[model samples]
Target: MKRETNRRSFVKLAATAGLCTLASPAVLAGSHPEQLAENEETNKIPKKSWYPLGVFKNPVLESVFLFYVGSTWQRLSDVGECFDTASRIDEANDYSWSDQWIKTGNRLKVLGDACLKEHHEFTAGESYLRSSTYYRAALHHYPDPANKIVKELSLKVVKNYKMALKLMSIPFEAVSIPYMKTELPGYFFPAKLKSNKKAPVIILHAGRDSWAEDYLWVAQQAVKRGYHCLLFDGPGQGKVIRIQGIPFRPDWENVITPVLDFLKHTKKEVDMNKTVLMGFSMGGFLAPRAVTVEKRIKLCVANPGVLNWTASIYNGLNQIDPQLLPLFQAGNYDLFDQKIEEYMRTSSYVKWGITDELWKYGVHKPSELIKKYQEYNIEAVAKNIGCRMMVIDGTGEEFSVGEAKRLYDALTCPKDYVLFTEEDTGYLHCQPGALAIAYTRIFNWVDKYIDVI
Candidate 1:
């Protein structure tokens, strides 16, 4: 038996998921198949309630559960019910996780609908938010983007999130950011502080697998601290990938530049001078990558700073029984692709990760995904980042092990590196179970550089 290093664990994460599409489930239920591991830069997201659930035997499902359940702190989910659902859902009995999550979401939608009928908007909104978070989490291990449920759940996520936003007592609006022959969809929540002064801004960015709405946790906290929050789905994220059909672009500065340009036109009192760019998950890389050129951001936060995302993706290549790199070097592309796909059959996480990324990136196969990712790194431009930077990382990272330190060491600008240890219950990527602590640390650090309020 081989010692599964951080990412090699993803191979097992697949079988741990044993997840199947909504289109087909019977064939995969209770059948855990082993998979090949290919690490990406997405190990930084997980949990709903901010308390990690170690009840599940499978680490992949553990991560999925952690991500959505940790949403309690954001008021997007109920931690108690999420725990009950996890307990009832058999971890090894594959393919039922998404279905069960949908059931829970449906139940909440019912309650929310009743609340709305009775004109209790606040209660209704809260229920809808939880419903949407469940629906969003359901997509975690769901393997096929072509499946109707993928789009169905995505629509439900936005629908519920919007309803919740509309019912809230905050200044909110939907925004369309002009891009190349298209527009990026986003949301804005102004701090609306009592003072007439412009509020400092915190631009929120979510990485692969998370949508624009998934970033509400950060925005919720920022708004409380009197910061105007801007969240947008870049190419390959949120509505961009779902509706407009745009793939990811390596030059993310193009994405952030337009966002910064649009802030002035928002007609709100936003302090552009104190703007902050904070990235989550794979976004940890995207945010810093953007600051390399867009200097308007006074503070840049990478939850786990990443160096060469391409190198990070292939970090565990040497440990595989038959290395994937050699196949590429020998031009045995078919075999290389076949081996990658073999994981799809064995692991739910691999299936979902590969398929979802392929669709988001507008690539046909796994190899093409790698080719596309090769263009998404900041090592060459790290020195060009003029803004103050902060790097965050947690121990026991599932995907990008040690990437934060690698990125922190590459910077030439003023920087800070914060490590979350297992003792603090922040061992998993992004400290999913300790979000309040995560945001508190971030805001306190930002406060040192700028007067956020």
Candidate 2:
């Protein structure tokens, strides 16, 4: 009832926008040559834009602030404290910026420990989560996987997250699901239902660079709606890849099938037939791909639907060199890797994007990585999806701007296309600043199509 009221208020203030619908099979065949050329030209030009400053310089820091908007407002973080700490960092120097983040994060951890000692459990829990968030923010744009500071901060993030989990209000289980030879780690948050009746479950996963902890805010929203939420670190994700060396594979069905098996057999509280699969960022591609093969999923949602991983890779690569494609197809990976590394050294954004992919894909060369991404195309498989689907897109999304429309057109199953505009304060990746509005629309759709209770 409260959420419904909030949704109505939001809808009243938000402007209605048209969805970019594409249904032609010919257009889905491939990216048009003319459009590719235009995209190449657009990538070559760096446009100056105004992003919120919050307490730091540059759009990256502003994006970070927006990403944590829900958490900060919910008291998981002290907004003033975060801003004060961020203000001290020298944003121009990556190493210095990361170091300041680590220092601030450590200070927060100490404060959290002090709060625990003083018998302030709620304060301590919130502080630990905030500390982990800060540590993760430190690594956001820092490219090198081998940097000792990066490794140290990553470990600290896990440590603080685990500490916070122990003190959270709702019961959460740190679970290890059987996957391949090794295990995949996850957190399962069951709904606090008074009855023993089965409840619908939502399995949430993150993109290439996001960790499971980053999804807590969204999970909390789902839990409030009486759904059990499972957030996991699959292959090539979070600690699984960062610590265990499991590279990403295009066949996410293999990964998600096992998770489904675990839930069906293990979680008695969950309604297996009502299970929904949701993925954010790169998971947009991964989730839909899985749902095509895994029919047990009742519903699927892809935030900014990704139809082709190859196109996504090319979009990022085009910023560096359009000639790189021939090198990839020709198997001249050694030269390609060298050139990419050289380009990475000059551009922080490129370095972060490319290096993260290389590490996650377990490839020594950019060409090899691109070759692996070629297997992740979903257009060929989209027609096979049996469940209802939702594709969300933002009008101002620069990365994969046309992807949602392409993916929507390819899907033959019952589907809904929702577009967020600047008026809704959600025309950014994953609607970072307007999650409340985003979740309202998402869950409302879920309730309409799927039985929630």
Candidate 3:
């Protein structure tokens, strides 16, 4: 994968940037010398009642059911059935949620196939979509990215997704946007009712681990509100990383610029002047970062603003192993990687987090990966944003504790901050359990800022 070559080049670049504190023994030994307990106490974030069950119980499974409620995919009773089935399986400590989801997904897939054979297209399509969601869910938090099971499940996710696409009532077009040397894959859903009129476009991109398919719930919302939705997989994300081996870049503006150019030149039905860019999860960071330089973006929405990727990594690393910082500063990347891998082996959360980051960032060593996060910060560039911005965060968001406020404060442009609270059951990362409320607030904000109706 040329990972070693990339690592060498990155380290050389870091050295040129005068970030060689890792090479200093004194820095390695005493840098950021604070008690681990004190650090934890100072930065402690309360765990959500839904997360442990949602992530550990089913591993990326609940969001599908939660977001798709009242939609064609499945009913609440069906979701309850799946949840009940999941509850029967012992939560395997070895991070076997992948296997659990696959088992349940296969059951739904079989039912869908049977329905298809019986000429029940609507039932078959809906079940297939649900099964596809479950298949994709299986890959989340799966420790071994290179496992045969992962590949098998990934292929099924795409296959079943295509099956659902074929049967969906809404028009969906598979698109490939020209980028640097390669192409970015995506799906374009044009506004159904506004077929004869030019409509505002909402461009959405997923974060580090999510794919374009995962945004179906939100995209449907945009479509319902008479906005054309374009959901694409950018660099270091989805097919771009999985198939093309492109690592994530800090300058997302370059990626988005091409997309904007494509939309302007090709899709004449899209109202470019009223275009909005929306990002979820890590996209919360990537979207806003792109808008800082891309002036064509009239409105930007980041669901939980990510002020600095480095801060999040540093906080997580502090919780994992404060001593590892010294190794990072000392440039002993091999030892650092070994220690971090050892620590990750003890927890599923750490395992998934590190493995996903390593894969997405295309770095071999833990220190190199952490260092790469420094480039993703937007503090220095926030003032460049000239459009209306919306920053969303859950009051209980763990990873990006105070990032929403920090990002909002830094923005010199017109901006709005929304904090979903526990009483609304929207106070979790990206407001997973409250998609309706989130979308209502999001589109209402969008309508207020732009002509989306």
The candidate maximizing lDDT is: 1
User: Pick by TM-score: which candidate is best?
Assistant: 1
- C-alpha RMSD between model 1 and the true structure: 7.6
With candidate 3 superimposed using the best TM-score fit, by how many Å does residue 189's alpha carbon deviate from the native? 0.8
Poorest 10 consecutive residues by lDDT, candidate 1:
19-28
TM-score of each prediction: 0.86, 0.83, 0.82
Q: How good is model 3 by TM-score?
A: 0.82
Clash-forming residue pairs, model 3 = 22-329, 22-330, 304-392
Candidate closer to the true structure by lDDT (higher is better), 1 or 2? 1
CA lDDT of each prediction against the hidden true structure: 0.73, 0.72, 0.70
Measured with C-alpha atoms, the lDDT of residue 241 in candidate 3 is 69
lDDT of 2 by residue, 231-336 (tens): 9988887778767778888888998999999998899999898988998877888899998899999999998688986785565454335676677667888888
Off by over 4 Å in 1: 1-52, 88-94, 194-196, 451-453
What TM-score would you give candidate 2 relative to the actual structure? 0.83
- Could you list the CA RMSD of all candidates, in the order they appear? 7.6, 10.4, 9.1
